[model samples]
Target: MQLSWSQPCSSGMIQLLLVSNLLLWECVVSRPMCLDIGYKKLFLQELFDRATVIAQYTSNLTMQMSEEFDENFAKNLEYKARNSSTCHTASLTTLEINEQIQQTQSDELLKVMISISRVWYHPLEHLVCEVAARKGTCETMLSKIKELEEKNQELLEEMKGILVRVHPGAEENAYPAWMGLAEVRSDNEDTHHFALSNLLHCLRSDTDKIVTYLEVLKCQVIHNNNC
Candidate 1:
C-alpha cells in the first residue's frame, strides 16, 4: 500500500468545520492555563470518542465476518496477515507510532495526524459506496473522521500551527508521519470485504494514536509543562 500524505481540502471547508466545532475558548482570559487545559482535553475527548466506537464496531464486524465466511479460508487469511505486519499494513503501525515518540514533540505529531485524517475524507466517500462495509457503519465512520479531522485542525491552529515547538536542539524532525489511507480497488467480494476491514482496522489504530498523543499533550499542559 502507498503510505503517503496530502489531502486536498478547501479553505471554505476548514472555516465551516471550525465553526461547527468551535469551543468557547475565550475563557482562556479568565482561566489559568491549567484550567484551560481541561477544556481542551474535553474537546479532544469529544472529538475522538466516536472514533473509539467505530473501532469497536469494526472489530466486532470482522469477527462476525469471520464466522460467516468459511473457517478454513478465514484461518488461511489470518495466517497470511500474520506473515505481514499487524494492525495495519501501512508503513506506520501501532508499534512504530508508540515507540520513541515523546510528548514534547507534539508539533510534528499534530502535523502528521492532520494529514492522516485528511487522507481518509475523500476516499471514504467512495468507500461508503462499496459493499465491503455495512451501510450505517461505514457512513458513521466517514462522517466522524471528517468531523474530528476538522475539529483537530482547530486545535492545531490554536496551538500556533504546531510547528515551532520542537525541542530546542532536537536532531530528528521525523514529522508529517506516513499515512496509508489507500483506496479499495479489488473487485472480488471477499477481497473487497477484506480490504474494507483492513481500512477500518487502520482507521481504528489511527484514532487510538490520536487519542494517545492528545492525552500526552493534555498531561504536559495540565502539569505545567512538566511532561
Candidate 2:
C-alpha cells in the first residue's frame, strides 16, 4: 500500500507534537529559558546592576589613567597630537547601539550587540597588550583592562545565547574599518609618548561608549515591550 503526504497522523502523535511545540514556545517567551541557561528575569535587573557597577568602575579607572598619563608621561614638550585613522579610539563603539536604535527589533538589537563585541574586543586587547609591554604601566589599570576584556567576552556570550532563542539567523556582521587599531612606530620619545597617550585616550573614550551602551541595553532587555 502506498502512503500519501495527506495521510493524517494518529491522535497520540498529534498530541505529542502539540505539547512539544508549546514547550518550545515557552522556552522562547520565558527567555534565558530552561535550566541550561541563566534564568531570564523580567527587566534583567540583576544583570543591569552588575553591568552598571562594572561600567562605572572601569570608566573611572580609565579616566584616572588618562589623567595620570597626561600628568606623568606627558612631560612638557612640543608633541603634535597624533590622531591616525588606524590608531583611533573606541568611543564610537556604541554609535550603532543607542536608545534610538533600541526601538528596532530586539533580535536585531541583540545581533548588533554581539557584533559590537566581536569588532571591539580585539582592538581593546591590542591596546592593553601594547600598554602592558611598556615598562612602569599601572598594575591596577592592567588588571582593570583584563577585567574589562573578560566582561566583554561574557556580554558577547550572553547576547549570543539570547539571539539563538530570539533569532537563530546570524549573518556575518561588518565591522567598521576604523574599529581595528593598527600598529604604529614608537621609535622616538615624542612619538612613543604621543602614541601611547593617544591609545589611552582611545581606550578611555571606548570605555565610556561601552558603559553607555550597556546601560541602554540593560534597560532595553529588562523592560522588553516597555522599553
Candidate 3:
C-alpha cells in the first residue's frame, strides 16, 4: 500500500483493520496463514521498542538543556553582581535588574521543560506500557502517535523562537552572555532542533508503515475468508 502524508489513515480505518486482523488470526491455527499472526505480533513489539528509545532520548535532551540553562543563568547573575559599581544606589539598581533577568530566563526555561514533558515524554511513556501489555487497540495507539507528532511539531516551533532570541547575534542578546563565562553555544541550539525534527519525521514514517502493514493484513484476511 502507498503511504501518503497528505492522507493519513483515519482512526476508523485503523480500527477496522485491527479488528479484522484479530478475528482472522483467531481461526488461523489450521490455515496456511498462521505464521502471519506471529509476524504481526513481532512487528508491533519492535515498533514499540523503537518508540520507547526515541522518547527516552528526547527526554534526556530536554533535561540536559534545562540544567545547562540554569547553570548559565546563575553564572550570568554572579558576574553582573560582581561587576556593578560599589556605590550603594548603583548596586541596588543593578541587583534589581539582574533579579528581573533571572526571573525571565527561569520562566522561559521552565516553559520549555514543561512542554517537553507534557507533549512528548509522558504520553510516549504511557504508550510504551500500553503497547507492551497489548492493552490498547491499534487505533488508540495510532491516535497517541499522531498526538505526539503534533506536539513535537509544536515544540520545534517553540525551540526555533527561543533559539532566535538566545542565539548569539548582532542584536542585544535575549539571554545575557557573561564575558568570561562559557556561553550556551549556537551549535547546541542547532542540535536540539535537528534532533527533534529528525525524531518527528521518523515517528511519522513508522506510523504510516504500521498502518500500511495492517491494511495489507486486513486484505489478506479478507481474501482467505473468501476462499
Candidate 4:
C-alpha cells in the first residue's frame, strides 16, 4: 500500500528547495492523514505556474537587456568620432530613454538584470587577449552572436526538416514565409544585435538543462549498471 519515490524527484526537490525536503508524500498513502489532497494539488499547480512565469519573465528581460546593450554599443559617438555633435545628442537621448523605461516600474525587469549579472557579468582584471575583444566591437559581438544564432537556427531547421521528412505536409501552413520572418525579427538584430547577445546569454544560462539531460542519461547508466 506504499509507493517509493523516484531518485530524480528526490534529488531535484532537495536541490530545488534548500530549506526542507517534501514531506507530505508519506501521508499520501496513509489515507491523506497529514494533508488535504485537493489543496495540496492546487498548491502544486500554483507552484508550477510560478516556476513557469519566472522562467518566461527571466527570458524576456534577458532579451530586452541584450537588445538595449547592443543598441548602445553599436552606433556610439565615441566609435565614430568624426561625426557631428551627434554623440552629444545621443547622450541626451539615452538619458531620456532611461527615464521612460524607469517609469514603467517593472521589478521583474530589474530581477532579470540581476540574474544575468549573477551568471555572466564579470569585472575585467586584465586584458592580454586582443584589441578586438578589448573593446566590445559590433563585429566581434555580432560574430559571437551569429555563431549561437546559427546554431539555434540550425536546430530549428533540423526539427522542422525531420518533421517534414516524416510527414511531408506537417508544416505547410504551420510555418509559412511570414512565420520565418517573424521568427527572424525575434532576433535582436534590430537594436544593434543585442537581441542576439541576449539569446547567447540565455543559451549559456540554460546549459544546465543539458546537465539535467545528462543526469537522466546517468540515471539510465546507473540503472543498467545495477542490472
Candidate 5:
C-alpha cells in the first residue's frame, strides 16, 4: 500500500508557520521605496525655496513702505514748521492723523509677512520628518498639501484686505506693480494682492503635481505587489 502525505498535526508547528508569515509581512511593509523618497525630498526643497523667495520679497516691501512713510512724514513736518505762524494746531493734528494711518498700514504689512512665514514653516517641518522617517502614507501627504493650500488661500485674502485698506478705489495706474491690465478696470486692486494671488496659484499647482505623483507611485507599488 502507498503512504499518503498528511497535514501538520502539532500546534507548535502551526504556530511557527504563523509567526514566519507575520515576519514576512512586516519585512514587505517596512521596506522603503527609495525612488519615491528621493522625489519627495526634491519636491519639498523646491517648495521651501519658493517660500523663502516670497518671504524675502515681502520683507523688502515692508521696509520700503516704512521708509516711504517716514520720508513723507518728515517732509510734511518740515513744511508745517516753516508755516507754523499760520495754523500751528491744525497742522499738528493733521500730522498726527497721517502718522496714525502710516502706523496702521505698516502693521498690516508686517502681519501679512508673519502669516506667510507660519504657512511655510509648519507644513515643511512636518513633511521633512515624515519623509525622513518614511512613516507617513501618500494619503497623509495629500491631506497636508490640501491643508497648506487652504492656509495659503487665506493668506491671499489677508493680503487683499491689506491692499484694499492701503489703496481704496486705487486706480490701476496707482499701483501698477500689483494690478493687472484686466484687474486695472477694477478700482480695488493693488500690487500686494496681485503678488499674493500669483503665489497662491503657484503653490496650488505644485501641490497638485505632488498629489498626482503620489497617486501614481502608490498605484504602481500596489500593482507590483499584486504581480
Candidate 6:
C-alpha cells in the first residue's frame, strides 16, 4: 500500500508569484524623481514664518480685549444677580407675613405693600433690558471678527506672492541687506530673487521664532472658543 499527501499550493505557483513580485518591485524602483526642494521650499518657509508672526500678534490683541470685556461683564452680572435674588426673597416674606397680621392701619399698610411689590419686580425688568442689549452687541462683535479673518487671509496670500517672486534660485548673485529693501521699494525684478531668499532665511532663523509662537496662540484661541 502507498500513501500520498496534499499541499496548499504547488511549488510552481509559488515560483510564479515570486517572479511577478520581483518585476513589480523593479518597476517601482526605476521611477522618476518626485520633489526638488531647490528654492521653492525656502520661499514657502519664509512666507509661513512671517504670516505666523502677524497671526500671533493679532491673536494676542484680540485675547486681551476679550479678557477685559469678560471680566467686566462677569462683575456686572454677579452684582445684579445677587441684588435681584435678595429683593425677590424680601418681597415674598413681607407679603406672606402681612397676610397674617391681626391688626394694622388699613390705608398705610396697603400703600407699603404696593411699594414693596414694585421694588421686588423692578430688578427683573432691568435684567431683561440688559440681556437684550448684550445679545445685540455680541452679534455685532461676531460679524466684525469674521471680517477681520477674511482680511487676514487676503494679506497672507499677498505675502506668499512676494515670496515666490524673490526666490534665490531665480538670481545668481546675492545682494547686501540694504540693496534687498531698495530693490523691493523700486519694484525691480532683478533684485527680487535676492530679497526673497533673504526674507525666507530671516523668517526661519532661531532669533525669529514668531511663527512657532503664533501657531500656538491660534490653537489656544480656537480651543478657548470651543470650550
RMSD of each: 20.7, 9.7, 25.2, 20.4, 22.1, 29.7
Clashing pairs in 1: none
The per-residue C-alpha lDDT of model 2 at residue 158 equals: 57
TM-score of each: 0.44, 0.59, 0.24, 0.25, 0.26, 0.24
Off by over 4 Å in 3: 1-31, 74-227
Candidate 5 lDDT over 1-227, as tens digits, reads 54346643478877999999999988777666666676755554444344444433443433343333224232344333332222111112111232343333333333333333334444333333432333222454334434443444443444344334434553221111221224213344333223223333333333332233322322323233132
For candidate 5, the 10 contiguous residues with the lowest summed lDDT are 87-96
Across 1-227, the per-residue lDDT of candidate 3 in tens digits comes to 78888888989999999999998887775465667766755554443344334444444443443233324332344433333322211111111232343333322432333233333333344433433343223554445544554544544454333334333332221222122111111245433323322333333333333233223322333233132
Error of 6 at 43 (Å): 1.1
Task: Tell me how candidate 3 scores on lDDT.
Answer: 0.38
Which residue pairs clash within candidate 5?
178-191
| Ranking of all candidate structures by their lDDT, best first | 2, 1, 3, 5, 6, 4
Residue 185 CA error for candidate 3 (Å)? Answer: 21
Model 2 has an lDDT value of 0.61
Which regions of candidate 5 deviate over 4 angstroms? Answer: 1-9, 30-49, 65-74, 78-227
Q: Write the per-residue lDDT of candidate 1 for residues 106-162, one digit (tens) a residue.
A: 555555554555455544445445433443344444455444435434543433323
Candidates 1 and 2 compared: the better one by TM-score is 2
Where does candidate 6 stray beyond 4 Å? 1-36, 76-227
Better of 1 and 5 by TM-score: 1
Instruction: Compose the digit string of candidate 2's lDDT tens values, residues 110-134.
Output: 5555665566576567757866776
Error of 2 at 52 (Å): 4.0
Q: Estimate the overall C-alpha local distance difference test score of candidate 6.
A: 0.37
- lDDT, each prediction: 0.47, 0.61, 0.38, 0.34, 0.37, 0.37
